[model samples]
Target: MTHQQILDKLSSKYLVKSIDEDVARLTYYAMCFEKDHNSQFEYIFPKLMLRWNCVLNADKNTVTDHYRLITILALCIHLHKYGFADKDLTAEALKAIDKLNEAVVLSDDFFRKSEEIKKIISSLPVPLKRKPSIPENITFYREKDVVSIQLGNRFYAAYIHRLTGVNESPVIEFYNGVFDKVPTIQELEKLNAKGRVYNDGTERISHFSVSGMKFLPDLANQIKLISACVEQKPPHQHLEKSVGLYIVMDIFKLQDEIKSIFKT
Candidate 1:
């Protein structure tokens, strides 16, 4: 089921007649936990998983919605894997790719003398998986390939079109590197500095929260971008708007959490 379908069912079954939050919450609980023990992030997990498995289990092109859904989810998973997780998955995957033989031997680990990079990488996230090549004039159409790079890793991939010639690593590598180099949150606050993350710290969108510092809009924008790029065709207007609205709704719920956190 698409998120809209789930929401529609939710409204009909619970929202219209009763104020009980349990039904909606319980359904989510069942969808994730009661059904799948592998499901992580109790209570605070992104509900995308609920609709995702539903779509995946459906048959055929009929599951078009689910394919699009997985595309975005994969990207988000990629982001988490890259950022809060590990930076090496994409790199290792790229290394095994045949076309990438021209990879420059940039900064080879001098383990013959000093630090061992492999051990460090093993402790990080797994490598990025290679994108399967799509045949030209194909039966199964590939979405226009846009680059999904490890921004922190410094190398960026030319996603859609096969760039005939290029020299660089994925951007995620660099992005990850730069962020690691940035001052810690406490240090930034002490310096009275602002972040360039969303904007110059002035354009605060209404957003939801998880931890005390990170807000839901952070996740929302990531979802929005991933959704747009995931489709076999361009994303529909409603798809984009739906993501935005969902984000707004998250913030509404998030507001109370913030209040409780600050309460005496």
Candidate 2:
């Protein structure tokens, strides 16, 4: 039987918690028991029935002897639960204890091997971490109500406005824009003429559609920048203290406005 199977059998009888339920406490107890199962009275007792205390003069040896008797009773209960009326419960439980001891040894060896392998891998020279090709900074160009975000030398127009009205999901559009100049009608016509095989043998550069995921991090960074700018109020000596306080309060609201868009 597996360690868990044996644990289940024992737990059902003694009513003590298993390693899975309380890993730290049970592991400590198991390690203590492995060292000298007879000497550990504090852990041997069923937690439901007996409580451990920090008393120096307590007869721990006697407690352990009593706990051993209770363990035998647990084995009998385990056997009875499995419909083994005539089985030698004491002998069977001793065998199970031997199996658990063997399992603990195997577990310890596996852990030791794992640690050695980790050390060996750690000693080997690792490859240098590569930097992302995309730049972190996103430049914003605001021309009236339209806001264009520049990413990787390419501009993308993004607008934030409610589609329906109050309590409705806002419409956020991020489409392609001109490289540096404001998109002219002639430039748009040039863009439309991409991938055309003319008799003069001229092909315009392919208009690559930008993926939303690529600009998402840059968009988040823009929101954070807005929030930071709002937080850092400009110093003014001419203003009254109360007026300055009110201005600070309004600036906090603006910061919230920046963050509120990302709440969903």
Candidate 3:
């Protein structure tokens, strides 16, 4: 079930009456935990595990809504896998576990790395904010038809579409990449898309434009971008936002691709 669907059912059964209100409350609490896991945050854990077994917030970690659900479901599944069942075990719980294990295992690992990096960054002293510098150790090299991006021990694949010989652009196709989800071009176009409410209460759409190749930079740059932001700035929520945006974009792309295939 989608996050909202799960939220709807849970809210109905629990007599919460309003999913929006519940989501807002849950999101606020989740944000607090993401910034710092403390006893005050402990109360929500039991309720989640015992009642919902899910997080309904769209941007719990600043990623897409689906991932917010998956992130919660992964933990729920892990708990169940270790022989800890919730108060009420339903088929939905099993389905969630199976879907995550079968479909998004790699994506789960990717988020796990992001979490590890966040912890490492939080423990380190504040790094001096020098001019944004790309690490020299990182390299992107093409061998045969494949371009490999290497940073430390991690490697990602980059694709250069030159066969058409017209307006060749480098992209990392979602299916060909390490990520289980990728955003569509349409989704990327909405990077800066936000509604601004004016003093008079009128709203206007504003957006930031992100380049295709910019998002497909070498793996090192992606890591550095998040890590540097964390090291230079305390309260590393930016790290989650950055990684979340990439994940959101990839997922949109993947969805669009699947839709097109079904159409044909």
Q: Which residue pairs in candidate 3 have backbone atoms (N, alpha carbon, C) closer than 3 angstroms, thus clashing?
A: 182-250, 182-251, 183-249, 183-250, 183-251, 183-253, 184-252, 184-253, 192-207, 192-208
lDDT of 3 at 106: 36
lDDT for model 2, please.
0.28
Q: Which ranges in model 2 have alpha carbons more than 4 Å from their true place?
A: 1-145, 163-169, 174-176, 181-264
- On the 0 to 100 scale, the lDDT of residue 147 in model 3 is 34
RMSD of every candidate to native, in Å, equals 24.0, 29.0, 19.9
Per-residue CA lDDT of model 2 for 178-218, tens digit only, reads 34523433333222211212345443222111211122222
lDDT of 3 at 54: 20
lDDT of 3 by residue, 1-264 (tens): 233333332212222222222223333444444444334234334433322222332234534434433444443333332223333333344444445445554345443443332232223223122212221121222111233322223323333222211322222221122322233332322233222234555433311111222222321122111111111111222122222112212211222332332221
Lowest summed lDDT window (length 10), candidate 2: 243-252
Q: What are the TM-scores, per candidate, against the unseen true structure?
A: 0.19, 0.16, 0.19
Local distance difference test, per candidate?
Answer: 0.24, 0.28, 0.29
RMSD of model 1 against the true structure: 24.0
Give the C-alpha miss distance for residue 76 in model 3, angstroms. Answer: 2.4
